[model samples]
Target: MSKRGNRLRNQGKRGSRRAAAARDGNDNGSGKRGARSGERSRIGRFVRRVIVLGVAVVLLAAIFLAFAVGFAARSIPSYYQLQASAVGQTILVRARDGSEIVELGPSFGEWLDYEEIPDTMVDAMVAVEDRRFRSHFGIDFWRTGGAILEGMTGSRERVGGTSTITQQLARNLFLSSNRTFDRKAREAVLAMALEWRFSKEQILELYLNKVYFGGGAYGIDSASRKFFSHPATDLSVAEAAIIAGLVKAPSRYSPTADVQAAVDRAQVVLRLMREQGYITAREANVDVDTVELKQQSGQNSVRYFTDWALPQLDILLPETSAPIEVWTTLDVGMQRAASAAIESNTPANAQGALVSLDRDGAVLALVGGTDYVETNFNRATAAMRQPGSSWKLFVYLAALEAGYTPDDRVVDTPVTIDGWSPRNSSGRNVGETNLRTAFAYSINTVAAQLGNEVGFGTVASMARRFGVSSPISTFPSMVLGSSEVRLIEMTEAFAAVSAGGMAVEPYGILKVETAAGENLYRHEAARETQLVPDYVAAGITDLLQAAVQTGTGRAANIGRPVAGKTGTTSSNKDGWFVGFSSGITTGVWMGRDDAAAVPGLQGGRAPAQAFAAYMRYAVKDRPVEEFDTDLDLPEWRLEPDDEALFGDPDEYYYIDEDGNLIEPGRRDPMDDSFDVEGERPGGREGNRNGSGEPPPAVSEDFLERATGGPVRAPDPPAVPPRQRPRETLDVPPAPSANRQRDGGSGQDQLIY
Candidate 1:
């Protein structure tokens, strides 16, 4: 205010102002101190909370570790128990002559002490699998942390594998292969248990002796013998490296699966070994070419037979864990021949299976697939494909039993039953012919008529009596071979015919015994009861022989008294040839697994060719046998009698170029133009003479007369192979609305 009221009065004013200024400065300093004090208090509270949280997290982790350890301790088995069950008893399967067929089940070669395992192998496994195996007690904390981090960030190459040898050993010995949280926890706990219970060398020994090495080899000893045909003691560095490399993925890196891949994997293992200072650089530089695998027969197909026979052994010796020897009925030579036939004749993108049975129903040979390594499905006994016209065996047998002869007259004209129409492969149906002619020709209409007349129940009974184990459909289409059946059963049925009407159960194992030579089970040869009358068998054999001589099955003729049938399904989905020659009944099937059509496949082509090829070799050593059953036979006729059927001289039949009987002089342009060798025109020349060409096409006018309406043959719809819905699907699959394309039958006639 008043500028200090002048100098004199200013003395008093100045004194007051200085006092106020000093008080103000003191107040400002106190406020700053209060703010600093509050900040220190807040920091102290934050520090205390952080300390409590850290303690809580540590406590929870401790609790979890303790619980995991307790659970693992309770579940872990004794080391001795693990060793005993690690590899089951080895199953030694021998052929009929007592020659070794294969060693199946858990095949452990020989147990070796920890010192016996090669140090190079131990080092390679440890270096590639775990870097700090000796330093880590059980879990490598550094790698585990990295694995966790990678998993959380979704960057782990694969999540949840403990990158340590001990963990892998724990999994191999006592854990399932599921990658769940519980499994991971148990794996970690068991890993720690293993590390604590056994020394590193002991753990390594167990790992080497328990790990799978593919090709059914378990343990290092077994793997060495399987891959190198040598004992583990003799495994070279390269061989050891290859065997050790299989620890990661036995199937993917099997020497038999891909030798180059195995060598490459072994090279990686060697480099890891050298990097970890387990071997010198020179020792790790072995040439891949030097790693020669044991020479094995190209026919690994025997594995299929062994795989099939192994299960049967259990039936003979139930629940017994002792090592047993299974003497099978397998003829090694015939098995090889069957494998060669299948490998040579199976079409690309298609699979083939064959089953051969001796007169006593002993399985002579079985070819499950063209390449057993590619697929071990055992289609001969497992695949349920439609038997096509091959199913007519049951229908014809039923007819023969019902007082009908192969020479009896049958009609093949276009006919419908209960809204189902089955067309012949050649589209045109011969009007009237004997059962033998229809049988030889594989006429669908005639077979369907016989199945209906004999009653579907009776036909099914005949199939059952012949050892057809699968469900038989009673649908109208079933008469046309719509029911699915196993190839083995079909072969067994044919074997029954070959055995002169005895019921036969297809058997592979002749005897079972302990490895110590104690008899466990021996097949007692009993006289088989007759399932079909002698006349019926004789009639079926006559029909079958005629079929091979001059019918769809002409390609299967082996120059002897061979009796067989050719079968093809709609859309060419399946091709089958089942026959008997020289007391051996063999059935062959060719088809795609997905039931997709193969454009040109036919039963008379590849299937019959394969049959003929195998049979020629199969019967070469055996005496030529005739199918004379000492039963009365009827006269065999090839052509239908139009004069007897219609009493019309104008409708006299004339033989066309492709083996069809046409009216008078009507001819197709496609006739006489077949490019097959040994073909003769103007008569039954193509399929009838084994030319493998389909019958001549039917005219549109003939189709109109057959169906009472103009018919167009459209592409057949794809029908999935049927499986039994309940225990069995006796109801037939819905027949296609349009005419079915010729199954593999070679004839162009629609089947269903």
Candidate 2:
């Protein structure tokens, strides 16, 4: 082949090979490009499917959130509706002359509007409870987020709560305080609703008006009045802070519960107020010492009287919601006197009670315990204790009604009946004595012999007739006051004797009326029924006068013609003195609530002293009048011979050379050994030297000489003193016997 031909052929073959190579390279390149494009398409499709799925999930979440928010919003209540509900009213108890004594019912004190509340109080509440109250719409998202972050971080310090003032108001007014998520969601929704319905000031005003402060105070005004004795508008910055801080826990921060805790909480509130720019640091600096917190009044002062009178309200105005005024017969002066008497007389660990009544049975004064705030036990009317020697009044009255005279002869020697032996309080029995001498000396043996002769049933009936409502046992011990009786009932019975034998029922509430002055009930003076003959009552009065003048009740004398009896029970568990003046009958009792024996306590000591102290004030302005006595009885007949009655006349009575009694149980002023300023053996007014101590034995001749007459022999065999069948008599003693003695035996003997 020619070179050109060979070159062309080679070139053709080479060009064909190159073209084939190019074609192969193009095929390979196109295949590689197609494979890359297929992979890119697959990746783009996957990305597109993922983006669509994410968008769908977001849309579903948005729809669910909208549904939940809508449900929560629907649960909100109308704020205006809640404001229209009725609130409870306070009940007022007033003195007889219209002075306010105490308040009853659910909420105490009056309610006030928002304008009446101080601005400091509002600022304090906002700063301490919700710092972002003004900026938030019921709930603060920023605060909520911070709290959530804090919880997630496990921070120790409490993260600020997210509830705004409006939120708190909503919860307080319309929602339950449940801590469930559902309740929280409802609270948030209700807060928003409240914000939408009311302005910021209106919402705050509602919150202040409805928030509970401690001490039964429901609103700011009530709380201010209860704690400071003033209106809410008059609250100082410190006071406002103190009250505002109570919202967290009223009882826990109550000043009455712990003043220091309340003060500490106030300090926190003040610090917050300063931090929030509500107050300056200087203004926030409060001296807790200068805070004059008002002491609790009404409830603490007259709890006993009010407790007793409260039960009567149900009967006065039963099932009624209206406020009422109860008029009580309590005399503030006498009540103060009684309270002072008990406080000054009783030991710190001991309890005492006093009840004073007018002749008509009007309860003038009543002291149940030392401090009513410490305890509400009404010891005066509720406590039932043995009367001890005070019970002898009935026994003597029964004997007198059984035709026994005060001059009748009775043996003071030990006597036995039904396996029971009775001895004189002196331990040594007086051989023979007249009834008057035995009665004056409080001889147990003589009293027992007389009680046996008259019968226990007779004494029990006499006590009932004299106004003793408690059960009276038909036992010989009843004559010695073994039966229990209430102080009030005993006082009433004594008042009956003072009222010339007329039965008197003690009453405190004089009238009950509505707040509008319409009378619900008015006390009418009940006609007194004669419980005993006037002569009989006068006789007992005479005897009791002698008792005070020379016997166990000498300590209770008020420098007037007073009649009373001293009673000291077994183990000194109870010490009592029930006395009566012309106008008042008062009973004083000192003892332990647990019935534990009070050391060194005797009826003639503290009890009689307290009685004298109280009566001196109780009868201050009243005219002193002498107790009525039976005119038929001889004036000096009841006076026993001191030498005959008490073994040593010098020990019991001071007699002049003329043989006339000078001072009973005391040294005569004329005696050279008598030191006027020196402490006497029986120092108290009503107490005698041997008042509660064992008596000394007297010779039989001394007894005859003391009686001012010869001792008559025992009645003949026609009626054996012990064998004579006793008859029960319900009448009190005759005036002759009652007026002749004021007698009670020693600690060892039970004599009245």
Q: Provide the TM-score for each candidate, comma-separated.
A: 0.64, 0.57
Instruction: Please write out the lDDT profile of model 2 over residues 1-752, one tens digit for every residue.
Output: 78899889888998899999999999999999999999999999999999999999999976875565566556554556655533455678777666887787656345456676678989988888888888887788887888888889998565235677777777777677788899887787777766666778888878887777777777788888878888888989999988998988888898877899999989988988998899998998878657889986534446687777768767766577677778898887778888888989986589999999988888888888888866678999898888888778887777665545555555566566555676555689766566666666667766676677666777788988888889889766667788889998888888988988888888888888787888888888998598876656776777777778888778898888898888888888999888899679999999998989999888888999999999999888889898777534332223233222233444455445445565546654544331223333445322233343323233346546765556543323322121111223333222111212223331111131
- Across 179-242, the per-residue lDDT of candidate 1 in tens digits comes to 8989877788889877767788877888788888887788889999988888998888888889
lDDT of residue 43 for candidate 2: 100
List candidate 1 segments past 4 Å from native: 1-86, 105-120, 138-156, 167-197, 218-243, 258-297, 343-351, 417-420, 454-465, 471-475, 525-535, 570-573, 591-601, 616-752
Q: How many backbone clashes does candidate 1 have?
A: 4
The model with the greatest TM-score is 1
Q: Per-model C-alpha lDDT, please?
A: 0.79, 0.74
The alpha-carbon deviation from the true structure for residue 248 of candidate 1, after best TM-score superposition, in angstroms, is: 3.1
